[model samples]
Target: MEIRDLTPAERRVWRAFPRGRRVDFTDRPPGPERTVRAKVLRALLLTQGAADGEVASLRMTAARITGRLDLKYATVEHPVSLHGCHFDEVPFLYGARVRQFNLQGSHLPGLDAATIHVDGVLRVTGCRVTGLARLGGARISGALFCDGAEFGSPGVATALELNHVSVGRDLYGVGLAAHGTVRLNGAEVTGKVNLRDAVLDAPGGTALNAKLLTVGSNVSLDELQAQGEVRLHGARIPGQLGLTGARLSEPGGTALDVGAVVIGSGADLTGLQAEGRIELHDATVTGPLDLSRARLTAPGGVVLDATSLTVGSNVVLHRLQAEGRVELRGATISGQLNCAGARFTNPGETALRASSCTIGELWLREDSLIEGAVNLRRSQIDMVHAEPGAWPDVVKLDGFVYTALNPRRPARERLPLLERDDDGYVPFAYEQLAASYRRIGDEAGVRAVQLARQRRHRGTLPWYARIWGYLQEVTVGYGFKPLRAAAWLVALLAAGTAAFGLHHPPPLKPDETPGFNALFYTLDLLLPIIDFGQEKAFKPQGGYQWLSYALILAGWVLATTIITGITRALSRQ
Candidate 1:
């Protein structure tokens, strides 16, 4: 910090700036105007070693500069530092070449650093800018810090705009309190963008408009409180985008709109609380997304709409208490989508609509309470780790193809999940469940699911269709229990044989038939498809003919039910 001796004109301007005591004070006392003009100011600075220029770097305290510090389109080679200063008018440093821009603890009306390139850090720590701090197209070779700074006044306008700016190192803005929006659109940062403990408010507008921002490392907005929306649409972050303990409050509008944003690492949005909807439509994350303990509310409407979103790793939503609907349609997760210990409440309407989604595995087992229906139609998951009693009542599993289902209950209790709703209990649902059983080598469970499907299928049919399914299920277990029908047939055969043996039917043609064996006669009438020739030759008279007619009808019913059972068994195999 080798501050050169000031000239008569430079010393006059230095006296106007706040002294060492004023640096700690919050308020600035009035001072005289600057006496050094642009020509004299440039000549005194810009020292080229020792011989070319005799002046040292311009390191001054309390630099209350007047007039527009217009260094635009100029080359400032010397290191300039002016701390604890107050500006009469905003500086115009666009397209200027400065070694460094350290204006910490300064009070400026505005800043227009567009296209200005700084070799060293651009620090404005603890400064209070009353107007816009525009840095569009400005390139900084080192870090850009605004820690403990306040930007913008009270209104719905852009407080800190960094559009198209390129920073070589980190951009730290911790404890930054922006009254209006903070736009970082089209900005590029090689290091992390840490905005931890920042407060950005814009009433009913965007709070942090970070569209198209390309960051090489993480973008942490931890413990941030935004009164309006936080838009990250079209940003490309190569590392994690953490929003741990953040709160976004925007009533009807979207709170966090992150559509089409690409994050190379996971988004750790743990403990995030949003009043409005959080939309992540079409976003691509290459790592795990943990939303554990987050409370996203949009009661009676969609809370989190993540349609077509792609996650490379798992999405952990453990203990997340969400209200309203969560639509994850067409999402593709390479890892598990765990929602254990989570609660989703949206009565009647869909609580979780994950239709056409694909996941490596699903965990919705213990302590998971979803009040509304869960529609996972056409979704494909490798396995489902669920508890039968803890799962939602109405789960739409039509076309939900999963390889395995591990439930903490017996097959009897778990099979009822497929039969709870007739509308969702389609043929594909049964086949999908059967496939899951087959994966675990549970042959009995597979047939049990198929039987339960028939039961549900019977309930959804017309009276005649119901009767047909009922007969098949009761007699043969809808081809699942073929031996059951065999046992019933044997009982009927013995009963019919004894009835005709004691009181034999008088034969119509005595010479056409031999000795009437009652057992053979009963067998002939018991089978509708096969005739043993005993029924055609014999003729029963009076009440005996009624017994013969009843047996013929029973044979037809038994034959059709048996054929149905065989067809179903073959189709399932």
Candidate 2:
């Protein structure tokens, strides 16, 4: 359009475009004087105007732009800055290439910048859009700023879509308020994606869907308040994915889903408050996963499901409060799994299910509270640092193996933990406890645990087998206390000697009999294998004969039990 056809606002913008001067119409009233035709603005951006030595840009503020800024498939050389401007319709810039696109504080119905390429930053800071802001498949050489921007109203399907978009620098959405889903699925950001203090409300639907998103640096969602599910499933972040102080609520459903994601620097979810389940299944984190002081509540369901999650470093869950089950089953942690001051509460079910987990060290300190059971079945942990009080009423330790135990308490204190296994009489649990004691050279603890194991095994045996087990325990303490066998032998010998000494027996044959001494006679009768010929030579009649018979039977009983107990003990060693 010519200068004669341009409105007063457009005339000012037209005259200022060559010199890159900003036309401020904030003082103008709402009339034709403050209105600029979109075609005039687009014409100035597309045409080359000669200037002295200044860069040409279409910069205008507080102007009402009428008609669509149709720049589809067009390449504009100059930059565009329309701050605090109001658009009559959505600007159609599909597949267009521009230097820099700045619409900061602009009020638009929506934006259609799909497949567009911007050489410099795209600033939409503090803008309000009542419809969808579609920027899918766009490529920005610089950062994409959307700080304090409001997108769509309530009940919208999608407020802002950046699917498959690529940003060379950071994507800032600090304090951004989106009423529907803000999708960044398959987007690639060379720098960080900062959505700190942002509020996303899409009740009963997804709030942020960033599946398969790849970020070169950190993705900060700290202090973000999301009403629906925030899915980052399959997203790959080279730096930390921080959600500290974030509040996510999606009751009876998933609040945060980061399944199968690969995080290079790990995740920081400290001080997070999530009402529904937070899934991290099959995720891999290179650095530490710090969830300290996070509160996750999903009663009767899983609050945090991190099954098969692999962390290169520590998983710090200190002071974490979880109302439902926290599943770490099949997880592999290279460093310590610290639950120092965490509280897990799931009344009738497993509060923490860590079955099949491979952990370097598991720290369950005295301050940790588990109201329900803890299932550690089939887990292989290098070391465990747990206080006696940290164990819950029921613990499933069958097939659980640990190389070392901290505080190295006596078996009396530690044995109770093994006994509390929900599956009654698990021999492996007792054996593992004994092995832990043996590694620390606690011989007494080993004996105690072994003896407890035998006792527990006795209860599961048949009635006749239990009887024999009881006899072994009473006489030799299941071979753990060898001195008890000797004591019984000495007591039986004294009684046999006294009974025969008081009543001398008659000889079977006078010529064949040797001189009968009380001690030798008793020894000959009580010892089964060794014979001193006193039993063949002597004939003890009536009550005295019965005394000799009783001595013989007692000897066989003691001899059989001692040999069996010794063999069992040797096999264990």
Q: Write the per-residue lDDT of candidate 2 for residues 296-372, one digit (tens) a residue.
A: 99999999999999999999999999999999999999999999999999999999999999999999988899999
Best model per lDDT? 2
Steric clash count of candidate 1 = 2
For each candidate, give its TM-score against the true structure: 0.91, 0.97
By summed lDDT, the worst window of 10 consecutive residues in model 1 runs over: 17-26
lDDT of each: 0.82, 0.93
Judge candidate 1 at residue 149 and give its lDDT.
Answer: 94
